[model samples]
Target: MGDELRADQFRTEAASPRGFRQVYVREGVGGVPLLLVHGWPETKRIWWRNIAPLAAAGFEVIAPDLRGFGDSDVGPDGFHDVPSHARDLYALVRGHLGHERVVAVGGDLGGPVIQDLSLRFPGFVERMVLFNSPLPYDRERMAGLRTRPPREASDYFVPQGTDADALAAELATPEMRRRYIATFYTSRFWAHPGAFAPEEVDFMTEPFGDGAKLRASFGAYESTFSEAARSEPTAMACPNPTPTLVLFGPSDHVIYPDFDRMAAAVFPEHTGPFRLRDCGHFVQWEAAHALNSAVTAWCGDLLAGRRRQ
Candidate 1:
């Protein structure tokens, strides 16, 4: 399953007007455009296991490294918040690739990004598949969803949000940075235990060895505490109306336990908050076959509709 994506076959880059070049993997052709957005501490490589399977399942799988996370260039202006990430994607998929409609799939930080994309450009994102990602918290509708990530599970958030510069400085060397990022895949228990082998961990953390990219990857966390990097008031208040299919990986230790409930509350037109056992936060990597099956099955009618068009 890990051998699904070949760099030579799908790797490509698109220039963004936002003053940076974005690197991505473009697989399959002449099929429905399915955009795969990756999250923090990861790059487009996170979807390596899912891309080919999804493409073969009859969709064009487009996975890009969010700005500054991998081969993509960081924003010259230094903003890496969810809105900025969403805009970059819009320019790449809609403006550049000429896809006016697409199925957006994401988890982790990528989850909020796809959410923003759907809300900001509803017509463009025709449908969505969200898993193990954060969703808007509605106090009334989500009153029964009280589970939060355990304190030990989230101990890294504060320093990453408030002291990025200091933390970046502390992780001065490439080796140090990779070591730090490796924890998220291994000791951090973000994935189901034993999901990743040593070589797999190396492949996932390699991009973080670049100190600059590693620091820039912290932009999402920094945005949590920085007013300038936060999403706009209107964006935060609006509910996402895109037809969505939500999935949960119960073994995840880093994300909120009640992610399904929150996602159900936020997406007005939504499908299953289906839970996958033995999977964790990194669903694409840990549950590749299941993810592919769910996406292909859920979007069957939409895919058929596109074929008719």
Candidate 2:
């Protein structure tokens, strides 16, 4: 929506350990706490459309801007990665919510962070809902998936280069800005072109209008992905056979092709997979009602011991 349209009201809170800044939006007065994590180049505001509905249905919701995103303080290193993001989320849960266990719902980059969090702190994660993120990249599969060769480090950080100033200027133009967002969302909304309202595009692009800000943000993604690729996978076991739900948009250009195989490999014994038709990467935004309904119903079933096998 427009800059003035406050999708959800948020309160700033101090994160423990390092006293890092965090923005949290909470709704509903009872029921289990649910944390919503957004993905790359996005902020907690992305979950705006879903918060009220869930809250109205008697669920408590908490969404935060991951480090270096939105108003949250960039981490001590001014970079973002899966481990650090997972830790930040942990701090938010344990320190702020004072909860030993809670459910986590994540999309895109957030998906991997949630996976890592559940792995690192097995006792803390109660349930997990992962969308459009593959399991940890496996070496054998990486070779088969490599349709394109890796670029040099310099090329890889194009958003961090000095030319980023010029790139931002070009992206500022209405036409280019629309194209940029459409490149990611259009494929998901192919069957429903009107799915992503114009305001949504504005909401997604407004934060990146500043060249330096955009560069720093993208730089973090580039750096983080590099580190996650090398970091050893956490060996912790699944937390209490927690009920897990996996969702995928069949048309998602980045994830659909590999999700089934990855899920079969990583969470072989537990979990149910739901694939949305004619939708792409941004499943929540593109199909909020359908997504929320499915997730809420699944949570209800799990709580009542009626979850599908």
Candidate 3:
């Protein structure tokens, strides 16, 4: 209850370069600097449940709405993409948070952005905590890819990934947009069953109600191939030096099951692909207590030099 009491104690701030005029929250006074990034179809509010535990663990927690989502400014057309998001995030951490090196935590699309930070802006991210996210599958990982029999494809990705115009117009209205975003919260193929209460569903989908926000969010998927390539030259020349803690949810339907396998080799200093039970895509939401515990423990161990990563 103490944590909850201090939950609203976060000091709110904003930065122009991040492309959002939205209010952002920063908590905790002193410790390791931590930046928490949220993924698509959701906002920084998703971090509400973890804020207290994480910030209480002795770290300045900076959580912000990604551009084009939540209360953030939705800029002009075709501007939101993965590489571009990384740029804004860099500014937010260095310019806003005043941290050159930080512990970055992310899930969903946020993971990719953090990954880019580590790759592009090396020495800036000391550690990473990623969950149920897409990781780069290089040669060995791809070769060893054990095709999970019935490769269930998403009817969603390509439409959003490739054809932006048609789908954007289709769900242009707020009501229609919310209706479409609702599917992810309810879809059996996605979230864990009974994962969302009615109010929670509305909260998660609220940001995507705007057409510009909804459309910009899709660019993440679209920029996947091109952006990942930006890091290949670096990856080959220099091994991934960032230590990563990968928390995985077996209940998640979309992400490949054995991604931790790919991640293990990819991130030279890596820990458990800690399999989480009774959770789905939104691991932090469905398993908040467990996620909080794991993150804090890792942070503690990391700071104590017990982990050496």
Candidate 4:
């Protein structure tokens, strides 16, 4: 991860038809551009380990601070739903990067964002990759959650989704907020225990040091409960046609078990729900070398015109 990363900023409109200011880092200037989207409890910097290798392998690696995370501006009046992020990404790739197509990859919240991108900009995506995320599963499976992990596993979701004002007040300062976000990197509920080194912890915590930004990350969960984000993907007239690749961490406690079924249902022609042994929800961080290798290889296959459109 030693390449000199370059930064670029685009107006919110440029990120999506209705998205906000996004700051992205790039590591190469040629080859098929790869758009990497980050997820919750972290920033684009989460890819710090994978980007250099992916770029050096000959792809333009572009990772952006998702709306309401990192230095990117919060979304429309704090509406940081998956649809909004997807739309912004569409704009970023089309209007800002001046490319009509890209090879897309995402994890965690990014999975949903990429799903929405496939929905909104159907022909623009050339290939897709996902990990540590969810597909649009049946409502019954969501109800099945009650039969799964102790509900306490999702206790954090309630406050972040509903009582955000109170949570923000509780984490009043940047340092205090960083400590709260740090829980994810160290908690069995999110990351594998002791997954981050002290320095890595600091790097992950630095962006949340902005109290306003920390508060903003909560809205994505909130959007799920809000009327804006509740529609089922089954309602789509068709499934996304883009060839897809999926990777997962076997030990994840956050994403419910049986996600592979949903992944298969959504992406019928997908590659793997390949498990990352001894890892958790943050597979990208925990399994960088394998992740980078798989993604680089997948991108290579895409560039070689081997994958379906």
TM-score, every prediction: 0.95, 0.76, 0.86, 0.85
Per-residue CA lDDT of model 1 for 1-309, tens digit only, reads 345433444667667656788888888877789999999888998888888888887898899889998899987788888988998899988888889899999999999898888888868888999999877777887887855887898999999999999999999898899899999998988899999888888888888999888888888988988887664522533367888899999888889888887788888798988999888899999998899999999888877876888
lDDT of 4 by residue, 225-299 (tens): 677543333122225567888887766777767665556556766888788877777777799888888888777
- Candidate 3 residues lying further than 4 Å off, grouped into runs, are 1-11, 18-22, 147-153, 225-239, 301-309
lDDT of 2 by residue, 1-309 (tens): 454346435544545454567666777645566788888657777787787787665567778877667666666655566777788888887776777777788887788788878878876877888777646555554455432312321242455333544666767755564466454444433224556666666666565444444544554345444553223444324232456777767565555465754554456444667777766667777778877887687678434442232
**Superposing all C-alpha atoms, what RMSD in Å does each candidate have to the true structure?**
1.8, 5.6, 4.2, 4.4
* Evaluation by TM-score, superior candidate among 1 and 2: 1
TM-score of 3: 0.86
Model 4 sits at a Cα RMSD from the real structure of 4.4
How does residue 164 of candidate 2 score in lDDT? 42
Query: What is the lDDT of every predicted structure here?
Result: 0.85, 0.63, 0.73, 0.73
Query: In model 1, where do residues sit more than 4 Å from their true spots?
Result: 1-9, 231-234
Query: For model 4, what is the alpha-carbon lDDT of residue 303?
Result: 52
lDDT of 4 at 147: 25
Candidate 3 lDDT by residue in tens digits, 127-227: 99988776765675457664241245366877887777799999869989998988877874467888787777877777678887788777776665345
